[model samples]
Target: MQSATSPLQTLLDLINETLSLILRTSLTVRSFAGRWQPLRTKLASLQTSVADISDSPHWAENPLLYTLLPNLLSTLQRLKALADQCNDTSFTGGKLHMQSDLDMAAASLTNQLRDLDLLLRSGVLHQSNAIVLSHPGPGSDKENLSFFIRDLFTRLQIGGVEFKKKALESLLQLLEDDDKAATLVAKEGNVAYLIHLLDFHNQPWVREQAASAVSLLAASNDESRKAVFEEGGLGPLLRLLESGTTTLKEKAAIAVEALTADPENAWAVSAYGGVSVLIESIRSGTPATQTHSVGAIRNVADVEEIKAALGEEGAVPVLLQLLLSGTITAQEKSANCLAILASTDEYFRALIIQERGLQRLMHLIQDLLSSETLEHVLRAIASLSASEPCARVLSSSTLFLIQLAEFIKQGNSILQQISVSLLSNLSISISDGNKRAISSCMGSLVKLMESPKPVGLQESASQALVSLLTVRSNRKELVRDEKSVMRLIQMLDPRNEAVSHKFPVMLISAILAGGSQGCRKRLAVAGAHPHLQKLAEMEVAGAKKALQRLSGNRLKTIFSLTWRE
Candidate 1:
């Protein structure tokens, strides 16, 4: 038992002992003596000790410790630092001390000590019997805290609406940053109590606060989310989505978003008619509501049924419109939601393209939007690029290709990945115009193929290179580059099992297809033959073809030499 309480006990003893010393000392104005200097030093040490207590790992499990310890520690440190500064000018028995300095030290010390006295006397150390006290109870020990919780629960049920509202508000305020409180709330079955208030409370303010509290509790905690769902919280939240005041709607939407973060809860929400409610909110809710509603849809978009339902409920057009003219946050959310939906079904992808979604996305990218907003826009384009028709449309645009290549060169890793993926997909069918655009940016493509880039980016770049080499015009441009042979050889690492490995080998084969003896010699000197032999042993067709290309010239040279002899 002593071991369990050691950390808290040590902190309490330190604080109380320091406070007692300050109280017992003679803090006279301009009193610089041996005792005064040592006392200030001790106080400074205590301040440092208290700061360390707040960062301890054990406090995470004890909500009372986690929440109240930091507050107490901060106040103690502030008082100690202030007192140290005030005590800097001291009086000696035979030395002259400024009267103003003495007075100032006296005033500051007096005020700080009074504040310290109030802090200790606030009953923060007395956590037991919290239910009877008007002050918020301490949470250091959970074993005895249940008594207070049970009593609070009983009173919450028997109290009037106003009292219940205030009690719930107090509970939420107390539990805000403390996971111990959150666990106790769920363990003691108080989640249902909060939901009841949200469902039937007479005051709009009460319901809003209740929803907000539930949102916080359920945000990342699976147990609380499940409890909220099983206790029938979804229906009231859905109704709130449709008809509540904007603030209430916002809180309830957040709660709904939290609950639906889990797929089971998302299915339950849709079963209770949440899809239509969310769609309606997106169509007509305030900018805030629409923003959160789109976020909620993004969470559930991975489920096939939910994706289809959202698409059928006229969500695609509404979301595209939001992407066009809504607030920046709304635009980001709408783009992400559309990206996920388009990824699920080709029909949805086609609809987005038909609605001119691609044009809006291109505009967002070209306008140099925020990195966050651009991330979603680029993701949407990447998803839509999966469709061949969409690919052709994107490849047809010279400006889009330029912007995409620039993004790959200048954007962060995420942008590089999506842009590379989109370009690779577009490379599935390279037209003459597409070939020209890609060849124009061959330097960036070569940069992407280097060692330090992510494997996905490297693989995608290889795919684009493969498509470019297919065009005879593009091949002439690529063969002249000095890094071309070495880059192709780099992709044949034996550890890479992805079919993307075949691209570079096939590209080399194409380069050697109609080349002079010099080109084959360049590839063989780049050590392509050994890697090709290894790959051909594994029965890779491209490796086999590339090997044949490298040796075809050598065999002809030998036969011609024999014929001349």
Candidate 2:
């Protein structure tokens, strides 16, 4: 019996002999001279590839080389026979048939050249050498580990289904908590190969592992995320999300979320019809899958053009359901997606309301403990509050108002800002009754306005106060709190450049319009005149109105007489 080494040696000898025969026969061919030269060149190239393979010490161990060698030897033998036939001057074969044979032989040689080139470029021979020579374990040194990683990538390029599967599994293990390795893989341009395995023709387990590897690399850093998207990873990822097993869907969803985190990539997701597949994943996937799917939806919904597609693809209803029933992470993502959709367009806000999203969100707010989730829930409610009907429903919920007040009082700056905006929205167009009820948050709103930093929170608080102060009770609450009232007046000072003078000026105008003579005297005592005078000169909105209100008709006449001096 011939050994494995014997087969490789025998194949090399046969290739050499056939090359010699082709060269000798080409000189004598009478017909198809044009085809013979190209065929001869291709055969010579094939001979060189086989010779190179024979020189490698581990070539016998390379399964690809072994599997390819026999077929290569067979092609060489057939070409040798074809060369002899073409060499016959009086060939009985029809001219067309002989020409056809030459074309087929040339095509076969070209295919063999391509296959050999792939094997040489694939580094499979090097991988086989590593397998035979080194037994690097999990605790190998950095150099060996890097070599191992490169080997795995080479296997991904050229290995069969089983080898590819093992390589993918090993890659996932290496990527865990190893940003350096992941970066190396990405820099080496292996991410595209991983994405290619997501094709449905690959075995389910292979696709799953590939998806897993992609998710790990994607989560590594910004560069890896860009690599995945730039390599055209989203299309196959969406396909995997659609048809893979539950675990595979979860993996694919994770990759999708990471890739779409950059808003620029969101357009690609929409272009690939990923919005609908992601919506389905949210609708039917497990808790983890739902979490990732909604997270992706949130990221993609950042694009203004894609929001309508999200709603058109039925994202709202599933997101609402996920918000109600998914895990905490899933709920946070769902609420965030809904918030984005509702904030962008009135149609989505109305659709969410039509789907009973408001009650579900309020329900989430009541029992939720995650400040993150609460922030998103507040954002959605704030968006919904833009609609007067939605505002009325929210304002009527005493519990909801109290929650907003609590968040304003105790939540982080982000929550405080969002809660204040929601309060402002809810106060619009509502009755004095609802205003009075919502004004229970008066103290917290004043405190927020008093905060010196994060001018946004101060702006939101001042804006909310303007909306709330339309009620008699709210104005009285502001008027009676000397310090809070002074804070509003101080914010109007032209020297306080960080604060927008408009909202504070409007709040003070509302205050002086409703307060008594005592309040007007207190304003003059607080040095309101010079600030309003400077703001009026600067053409700040409502500055002249508040100045006029503060001076009153008698003070105006007295100031005019003094100016005439």
Candidate 3:
């Protein structure tokens, strides 16, 4: 308590003390409303003589605690610095009250920013305005804002928990602006940010939408790819190929598809162990994931390391398991993988066949035939028939034979054609195993021959039946049994090329091979014994003539009444 001083000096000292308090409160970057209006009133009373002092360059810093002018960029910086401080734990721990203060300050500062933005747009002030936006330079330009934004983004990227979250939210919001949005999210830069979101974000919607945005932003840009690698985006994506949520995993896979189109990215994906993940995903993921993952792997399947990695991953067992468990799309992809292996690795092909791969393929074909999923069934069958071991695998299934018979019983000409082709291949390359398989399917083959249809199918049918006669156990039962002799003779009537060419050759071969057991007895009882004897005598008497007549081509055309002219 010193002696009383002059009234103006008291007021000046009081104002200086209040400014000290102002400095302290702002050190934590929080606003203080206590006595704010009263102080403002007091400061306003004293500003009459403060006019010339305000024109100083530093006047914008403060006017003895009556800081005004929303256009002052300093105030905006102060607000942002406060947000950063609040985000930092150490800065806010001793200052819980700072958050509310910041909220208030931010609200006020935001209003001022809006006003300043309007003023800048209107060009009403002495300062350079939005026109200055058209041509950017070093000082006091939009370029500074760009640099500031980029710095904020970088800080957020490597920042701690709270700070990083705030940084992301702020940056995301800023991107909603049209002009400011383009500054950073140029097509290429967006890719980096988006890949990071896929790699790091735990929110599904966030990851999904960010990935979608990335898709649009990267639509044509060849740049920004380096940003993806620098952010460690590839490894996380491969890992995500397994564990991410449905939507996120899909987006991540699509992103991988886009990035891996470039050779370097394909290598990058492989180097990150993507092949194993993708192959395993075929077994464990949803049908859609399996499909997409297969496609992803196919993109790099030509790479030796990627292919070797897939093999080492025990993909065959998983693929087999998927054949037992997966959806149609998964089955398609599994078939494709098998095709790749069959063409590229003989040992792998042998391994799959040894594991009853052909049995499963045959079973799948039957199911597809039943379901009328023809394209996939054909593909699976094609995959099977291309290899010898696959044929061995083919002989193991009795259920397959039953289904083939039913397929022919349906009397679908196409099904008959396929069955004939399959049986012919089997009979032509006869093995003990194949005979057993044909025994299973022979009933179905006999049923197909009994039905009536186009002449073209008869020749293949005859050839197939004749080959069956080569097996002694099946001969008398098939040839002489149940009015089959009449069908066989009618099939060779020369009205249809198929029957004409195939039936006689096969019939003559069967009779010669037969040499009159139950077939001769049955034909004698059926009253065709003389006809057969004559045919046999004719063949014996004119061997070369018989051969030439058999060799002459027969062309018969059968038109369906099923379709209208």
Top candidate (TM-score) = 2
Clashes of each: 1, 0, 1
Q: Least accurate stretch of 10 residues (summed lDDT) in model 2?
A: 127-136
Candidate 1 structure, TM-score to reference: 0.66
**Model 3 per-residue lDDT tens digits across residues 1-565:** 2313533334434444443444444445333444233333333332322233223323232211122232223443454455456445566344456646555665554444343333222221222231121222335355545543443343334334444455455545444433434334452133465567766776665565665544333322344344454566667667667677776566566656556655666777667767777776676666667666665665665566776776778777667666666666656556666656655766666666777776676666655433323433444454556677555444344555445545555635666666565556545655544454455345455545644465445555666667766776666556545656565554434444333333444554564464544554454345443443444454543333333333222111113333333
Better by TM-score, candidate 3 or 2: 2
Q: Write the per-residue lDDT of candidate 2 for residues 63-99, one digit (tens) a residue.
A: 5556567777787788778778877776789989888
Candidate 1 lDDT, 1-565, residue by residue in tens? 5534766666666666655545444364244454356545545544544444333433323323433444455555554444454455652333333334444544554444443333223232234344242423564577544444444454455445655666666667656756666666666636777788777878777788788877776664788777777888888888888888888788777778788888776777567778889989988888878888888887888777787788779888889888877778888888888887777788888888888888888887877467778888888888887777777888888788878877777778788778877878887665767677657556556667664456577778777766766766666676566676566677676665443566667677777776657678777777877888888898876788788888887789889999999
For all predicted structures, in order, the TM-scores are 0.66, 0.77, 0.45
Each model's C-alpha lDDT? 0.68, 0.77, 0.51
Ranking by TM-score: 2, 1, 3
Off by over 4 Å in 2: 1-11, 26-38, 54-71, 81-112, 122-129, 132-149, 200-202, 302-305, 428-440, 452-456, 466-565
Judged by lDDT against the true structure, how good is candidate 1? 0.68
Model 1, poorest ten-residue lDDT window?
A: 116-125
